[model samples]
Target: MPFKTEEMLLNVGPQHPSTHGVLHLEVTTDGELVTNAEPTIGYLHRCFEKYAETLTYQQIIPYTDRLDYLSSMNNNFGFVVAVEKLMGISVCERAERIRVIMAELNRIASHLMFIGSFSNDLGAMTPFLWCFRDREEILKIFEEVSGARLLYNYYRIGGLAADLTPGIEDRIHSFLNQFEAHMLELDDLFTRNAIVIARLKGVGMIPRETAIAYGLSGPMLRASGVDWDCRRDEPYSIYPSLRFEVPVGGEKLGALGDCYARYLVRRAEIDQSVSLVRQCLTDIPPGDVKEQVKRNVRPPVGEVYVRTENPRGEIGFYLRSDGSTKPSRVKVRAPSFCNMSVFNRISKDILVADMIAILGSVDIVLGEIDR
Candidate 1:
């Protein structure tokens, strides 16, 4: 006689460690294999869009910081750029370079967190520590520049809140010199480990078409061999002049668009970001960091949509101005929110253990998803 089988419905979390945040996954499984996965969000929703409409343009900067707390500087960059476009304000060259440097540094820090947490989710603890150890250096630099370690409301409508502090570039260069060697060490320790390879390789594959259909962005979209990056294609702020490679998942490591592929893409992006930072340091010009603008920013009656390449993906802000101090409408195109839409599609027919690997690879920030 054939063995009897039964399907079980499993609730992964509103509090589970593997879910990454306050996200609930209603996963249906047959023994160890997951047959279906439905991600239930909104536990952390703060009505971010509604709040933006009520606050003045400057006031909303701090709230954007809360959306993707890991990449707060990028969030600030996207919002300010949008408001600047609406107001027709021109940012100084020096401020543009400063914003790019800060945003890229935040990208590196955010990816480092992903690396650490993803490794922890896969059952290895050592890489997690190593990732955080390196990430701390970046965070310290942020603190020095912004005076806040986490939610930095450092970007203004026309430019930055302040210029880069003296000697900060030297500190950044020193960190970059050390970070490259440490990255190689991390690769040897975890990226090539047999256990990690077995868990990640050929698992949770998302095809290029599916990724595009779902509007996935950032590393998730690139890892699927899409070869699209808003920074490169869209050309926002100083990104037009910067030179860096957009890493994509190819057949070299366990087929394209797999969990392992995403991991490799993120690791490679860290290197590219390091290179971008060096270019910013070498070419950064001296000029007025902030443009002269009215204290109460009242953009002329119009609407504008601006997108920036954030650490997670493309962060866009749509603003409708009615010649008021406050925006008439504010809508944020959050990358985490869009990326999470593909979870149910990709998680189908994978092992429950593999589901964890897939979720880690997706790297959703619940704050942004639930917003």
Candidate 2:
């Protein structure tokens, strides 16, 4: 006689480590295989958009820091650009270079967190330690310039909160020199491990078309072989002046658009971010970093939508001003929320263990999703 089977429901977390944040994965399973996995968000409900209306333009800067706490600098970059566009204010050359440098450094820091956390999710504890060790170097640099390590509300509507601190570039260059060698060590220890390959290769595959239809972005989109990046395609700030490669997944890395592809793509982006930071450091000009503007200057009655590339993906802000210091309307196009929409589609009929792998690969930060 054939074996009997029964279906069951499993909750991955609103508190579990595998869920990455305050996210719940409702997984329906038949024995060990997951039939479907649906994500339940909103454990951290930060009403950033609603609050934007109540607060002045400058006050909203600190709030954006909470959206994707990992990519706070990039979040600041996107919002300030939107306000600047609405006001028709162009920042100085020095400030623009500094903006790109800070944003790219944050990108590196964010990816390091992803590497560390993703490794921890997969049961490899040492790579997680190694990642955090190197990541601390970047955080030190951020703290020196912005005066805070994680949530640096350092970008401004017209320029930056402050100019780059003296000798910061030398410190960054020193970190980059060591970080490159360290990444190769990480590659040997984690990326090429036989056990990791068996666990991730050919698992949770999303075809290029499906990724596009589902509106994925950042590493999620690029890993599926999409040649799109908001920084390069939609140039903003000093990104047009920077040179870097957009990494994509394919046969060279592993199976196209699989869980492994997502991992590999993010790994490659770290190198590109390092290069971007170096370029900004090399040619940064001298000028007043801040453009003189009122502390509560009002924008002309207008609406503008601006998108910038964050470490997670494209972060766009829609700002409508009624000639007031506070915006009348503010909406965010959060990349993680868009990327999470496709999870259930690819997650069906995989092993429950594989579901965990897929979720880690998604790298969802619940703060942004719930916000």
Candidate 3:
């Protein structure tokens, strides 16, 4: 006679600590194994797209900041670039380099948060504190440049709101030097820890085909052995001039598409971002940060779609203009939203603990998902 067990339903909260931010996971379990996992969102919905339609193109930048609150600079970059494309305006050379520097710094900062939070979810508390320590340094730089730490409305339609604040470049160079050493310490502390390796390796494996079908991007897609990166594949702004390798995951640290692979990809990206920032610093030309963009900020009656490589993944903006100062329609292709959709599929048949590992690996920010 076979052993009999009953399935159980568990709600992992729109309030659970590990759900990250106001996300609820309706999980079905058979003993310790998860039978299915369904993500329930909308707890933090601010209707950013709707707000964008009502506000001026310049005003919509702050709304984007809330979408991926961790990667506000990249969010600002994507929206401004889309509007600039629609208006046929080119930002000055210095502005382009500054944008790249800020975006890459934000990328490192965002990944640091992921490193901390993901490790904490796995029950290692040390990494969480260490990662935050490094992240705070990046936030300080942001605060100095933009006058706000979290929601930086720094990027304008044609250029940045202002050039890098005085002594900001020196501060950035100093931070980078310190951050590089800390990254190595992080690798030793968590990446190679035997227990962490065992927990992450061979868990929550999403095949390359499945990942692509689900529209996974960033480290999630790359962890499944995909070589596509928006920064390299779809060159924009000053990215084409910069030198950096896009990290792809495949048998480097365990099986392809496992939680470990995803973690490794993000780990590698921090190094790449550092390199990009260094390049931007060395090659940044001097010119007026703000271009001769029209004050009214009205675009021709047309639509434009722009995508950029955010820390989470590809953040896309679709803007439709009706010859008005405000966007007629604004639709955001948030990476966290697309990445989260694949959770239920990958979480099926995994252990409850493994489900957490998978969730952490995906790195979904509820702000972007519910926006």
Candidate 4:
């Protein structure tokens, strides 16, 4: 039968569990295959940027924590780096080391959710629970350091809110020793599993050139064989001093771009992050975690763009400041937003079942996308 004249428009979510946190997708489909998809955002918008412009530098860290609540440490780093640049203040040595450790730990936690949820999308239940088990250990580290698990307002403008408690390093070291085995086991279970490879290897393929053209950064870009990592390329916050490889897509079926490639890139990144954490612990200089600053922090009127290699991609914050106690404008170039832009392009040719899997592989958070 020939196709109908009018395509059916279906809404995937404002409330769908698969949409991942209040993201609404206006998906136009010709039966089982999506023809066009438009992401409808702002359903969970806290207006963090608008609020950021109104609040002082010190006050904005908590709001940043809400942008992508999964990896609040990255959000904290993004805002504070921008403010620190504006104020011309550098964080202390120990603060930078602890910040790196916490941020990378959070990255692993976010990736754990990605692996688990991606597996669940494909009807695999075991990997989901197995992944979360390890993630819980990472959460314990966060709670010990920040006194909060999810939205940790731990990283302040010029330093950490506080120093790590005694023996936290020992706990982290033990976790690292065990988490490595867990990650390897999980990888063996799913990364090389026949069913997952069949579903993902050739589906939702994104080319390297197109990924760059679309402004895709982070794992999504790297999965397409683009060797760009913000931590290595544009080093900030002691990352330049760290040793970690950028895991770009490798030769799989002589092609470097697909959902499978993205998964591989992220999986490789977990190992890299773990190694980085160990190095940070060894190299962290003894110093004050908190830097002294005046009561009212007024940076000279200017602007700065700071980017971090979040688990999602290049999470960026652009801040404009006037010589006031607060910012004039704050904009987030959220990776999830850019990563989601490819949905309409890629999902049009795939099976409906693959749509959820593909979307999950992109690892989006509606909070960051809409914000």
Residue range with the least summed lDDT across 10 consecutive positions in model 2:
283-292
lDDT score for candidate 1 against the true structure: 0.90
Question: After superposing candidate 1, which stretches have Cα over 4 Å from the reference?
Answer: 1-3, 252-254
Q: Please, what are the lDDT tens digits per residue for candidate 4 over residues 269-309?
A: 89999999999888457899875787568889899888887
- In the predicted model 4, the residue pairs found to clash are none
Tens-digit lDDT track of model 3 for 39-117: 9999998888888888888878888888999999999999888888898888888999999999999999899999999
Name model 2 segments beyond 4 Å from true.
none
Clashes of 2: 0
**lDDT of each residue in 1-371, candidate 2, tens digit only:** 99887889988888998888888888899888889888888889977788889999999999999999999999999999989899988998899999988898898888989888888888989988998998899889889999999999999889889888888989999999999999999999999999888999988898999999988899999989898998999888878877888898986767799988899999999999899988889868889877578889799998898988888888889989999888999999999999899999998888888888888888888888989
Which portions of model 3 miss their true places by more than 4 Å? 1-4
TM-score of 4: 0.96
| TM per prediction | 0.97, 0.98, 0.98, 0.96
* Worst 10 contiguous positions by lDDT, candidate 1: 248-257
lDDT of 1 by residue, 295-371 (tens): 68899999998888888888888889999999999998999999899999988888888999999999889988887
